[model samples]
Structure formats: structure tokens, C-alpha cells
Target: MTGWCRRVRRFVSGRHPPVPSLLFAAAWAYGVTGLFAALDPLAARWRPGGGTAVAAVTVFLDLLLMRALDDVRDLEHDRRFHPERPLPAGAVRVRDLVVLYAAGSSAVIALNAAWSWRAAVLAAQLAYGAAVLAAHRRWRWPPGDRLLVNLLVSLPAPVLLHAYLYAGYLDASGHGAGWSGAVAVVVAVLAAGYTELAKKITRAPRPGEPAATGPLGLNGSVAVALAAPALSAGLLAARSQAPSAWTPAALLAMVIPAVAGCRFLLGRARRPCAAPALHLLLTFAGYAALGLAR
Candidate 1:
């Protein structure tokens, strides 16, 4: 039992440090919810409340669950290419993660159920996650070695998470944003994709490592990374009632990733991993500020 506890501690500390992970989840919850409320005509004066708090907690736990499942799903690959990771390095056992996942998922469901019909949305996300896990484990669908294919298959999870947040906001405010909610989802997904691609842009990937640079090459990967955020910012500005006010902030937020890409192209040895994270932080913070101001 003590050994298991130690492993769990090591895994959590290494893979999902609580403070930063919780902060990221909270930012995502508030930022996405705020953006949706602002975009939706019916959600005037929508303020963060108990529902938003619940959503933040739910997102934090759900993200942890996703991390556990992903680590398990990629165990074999990690053993080959990322043996330093917790699971591959024997710092944590699969059953330890299973226990953590079960506890975290139960908390998420209970929190959602107590709050609103957001429980249904949460359930759908969980079901989809389970289905994907099963497909990977049982049928080996979308071959594990194919990074782009796996990415496409996994992209819907974030979209569903964004939808779940929107649903929670609606439940709290008793108002719907009509088409703006859908647009918000698209914007959020694009931001997520941009971050994912940006972090993995490399000229030389380790043997069997799944990176966008593998198929797209360094320049092509960087281009796509730059493009996703630009398109996302454009969509966000187009959807905003005050595009003139918001467009500049969005563009400014984008400069981080652009500069990172430029430095990377100039033959920087270390990847600018921090750039994508900063871009996300700035963009989301800007959106949340704009939404709350309105």
C-alpha cells in the first residue's frame, strides 16, 4: 500500500502537477464559459457562480482522468520512445491510475449531477472516452503509430468538453446563445489544435515518436501551427459584436507563437514549448476579460 501510494505521488507530481493543472483547467472552464456567454445574445450579464465553480472542478478531474487513460493507452509506445515517463519508467502502475480515475470520475459525475443537466453532457464525454479506449485496446482502431490519425480521432474530446462547459453555463443562466455557442466551440477547438501542434513541432523526432514534424516536416508543421491560431482569432473576431476592439488583442496574443515559430526556423536547438502555452494563456485571458467586460 505504501509503495502504491508513493508511485501515485510520483505519477501525479510528474505527469499532472496539481497546482498548474488545476489552474489550467480553471482557466479553460472560466475562459470558455465566459466567451460563450458573451457571444450568446441571451446570456447578458451572465456571471460566474456555483455552476462555473462546479465546471472548473469537473474539468480538472476530467482532465486528470484523460491523462491517466492516455498514459495507459500509450504505455507500449512510451516504453519504446519515452521510457522516462511515469508508467514506462515503472514509477506508477496501471491499477494505481485506474483507482485514481475511478475516484476522479465519480467526483466529476456527482458534481455535475448536483449542479444541472450538465451531467448528461459529462456522461456523453465519458462514454465517448470509454469507446475510444476500447477501440484502441480491443480493435486497435486508428493504428497507434499514426499520430495525425490518432489526433483526429481524439480531437472530439475537447470539443465535447467545450460543449459540456457551454451546457453548464446555460443551466446556470437559463439562457441560450443560439449559434454563437457553436462558434465558441469551434474557436476553442482550434486553439486546442494549435497548442497541440505547436508543442510537437520538431525537425528531428526521436525514433518512433509521434510528432507532426514527422509527416508534415518542420516548416509545414510550423505553418499549420501558426495558421490554426490565426484562423481561430479571425473566427473569434468575426463572431464578436465588437470585432474592432477584440481583433487587436487576438492578433497580439498570436505574436508569441509566430515569434516562436520564427526562432525555431532560425535553428534554435531547444523547442519553444513555452510560447504555445503563453499564447493560450494570453488568448484565453483576453477572451475572459472581454466577455466579463461585456
Candidate 2:
């Protein structure tokens, strides 16, 4: 709003009144995911935590470059509500973004070659990125297919989480990471389903035609609830089997925010209001907790 602040925003965004779009991407995807990366090191059995380090590095690259480009595509409509964003306000450095995206892709590919399992992870991420670009091109297509694409595209976080859990568990000489990985898989699917259902409810048909199911209605809510206990169970079992300074505290702490957030989202779905970026707060807190837990 002030002259000095405006100049700073413009300098970073490449135009007047920076859109805060990049900031959003950084906080929501990178910052929080960084936490997952940090915590992931703890979950793994590898010396010095190679998998966790690799995963964190690669994911950050995926988000900044691939996701930010997608954000650019939304400039036309986003301007209405987000006028200060880079694309809408014309402050984002298009050339810089172009370079950053290319660099990120190249870096991930190189890193993928460094690890066996990681190559698969990188592939999945690329697949998701391509899917998003395709979906954006066909945004006006049938809502159901669009929803599916969105769900599939948003799955990298949980997938990465699973990779850590799987490798970590197996490394510890415990049962196959497959057991924990299965839980992660189920959670990923359920989370996507709930979100898709919630979004559907948010953008339902005409007012006259009633929505038989509310946001996160039966299928979605139940699915999320199921993931909660599975994760909590893992945490609790970890604590019970080997009580430690970090295990119990981390296990229990996440429950509060996770439950509260789920409840808050469900309520907000019924009637929405601006809350000064509750998403940023949620993501930061969640990711930080996850990382510190490790």
C-alpha cells in the first residue's frame, strides 16, 4: 500500500503491486513440504538420511517451477480476487520464471538419476505436472473429469510421505514399509476424494437444484476420518513400542491441528468467509510440526 512497499513488490514480481502469487506457492507448497522433508529424514533408516534429502530437494523444484507456471495460466480470472498477484498485476518476471522452471526440471531429472526409487518419484511428479497443464487447457470440460485430474495432480505430497515411511520402516528392520506405505496410499486416495467432493459442493449446480451431499459429504468425510486413525495408530504404536522424547509428542501434536483443520474446513464449506489466509497458517504449522517431529 505504501510507496516503499509497492516498489519492493514490483521489484520482486516484475511489475506494480506484486500479486503475492509466488508467495502463495512458496508458503503453501515449498515451506510446508520442506517440513515433510525434514521430518522424513527421521522416518528413514538410511545413514545421514539420503532419501529424505533427495525427496525434499526434488519436490521443492517441482512446486516452484511447474506449479508457478500453472499459476500464470490463471492470471485472467485470478485478477478479479487477487489483483496484486504477479501475473494479474504484471510484476512477476516472466523471464525469471521461465528460467527457474527450466532449471527445476533439469535439476530433478539429474537428481532422479542419482537414486533408484527416486527416479520413480520424479516421474510421478512430472506426470502430475503434465496433467495439470492439460487440465488447465481444458478447464471448460466436464466437471467430473476435471475434478479427477485435480485430485491426481495434487497427490505428490502424500506420495512423497509414503516413500519416506516405506523406506524408513523397512530400514529399521521392522515389517516391510509396504504396511505403512499402504496406509499412506489409502490416506492419499481419501484425502483427494474428500477434497474433490468438497470442491464439488463448493461449485455445485444452480440454486434451485439442491446438493444431495454437502461438502466432504459421506464418502469424503469418512475417508478422511479413516486416514486419521491409521496415522494416529502408527504414531501411538510407535510411542507404545518405544517411548522417546520425539515420538509421542510429535504423534499427538499433529492430531490437534489435523482435526481442527478438518472441522474448520467442513464448517467453512457451508458458509465461506475470508480469514486472512488460513491456508498459509495451516500449511506452515502442519509442515513445521511434521518436520520438527522427525
| Best prediction by TM-score | 1
Instruction: Please write out the lDDT profile of model 2 over residues 255-274, one tens digit for every residue.
Output: 43355445655654431222
2 in model 2: Cα distance from truth in Å? 28
Error of 1 at 123 (Å): 1.5
* Tens-digit lDDT track of model 1 for 134-251: 7888887777656568778898888888888888877777765478889988887887777888776677767666655657766776788888888888888777644356556556
Determine which window of 10 residues in candidate 2 has minimal summed lDDT: 271-280
- As for candidate 1, its clashing pairs are none
Error of 2 at 117 (Å): 3.1
On a 0 to 1 TM-score scale, where does candidate 1 land against the true structure?
0.91
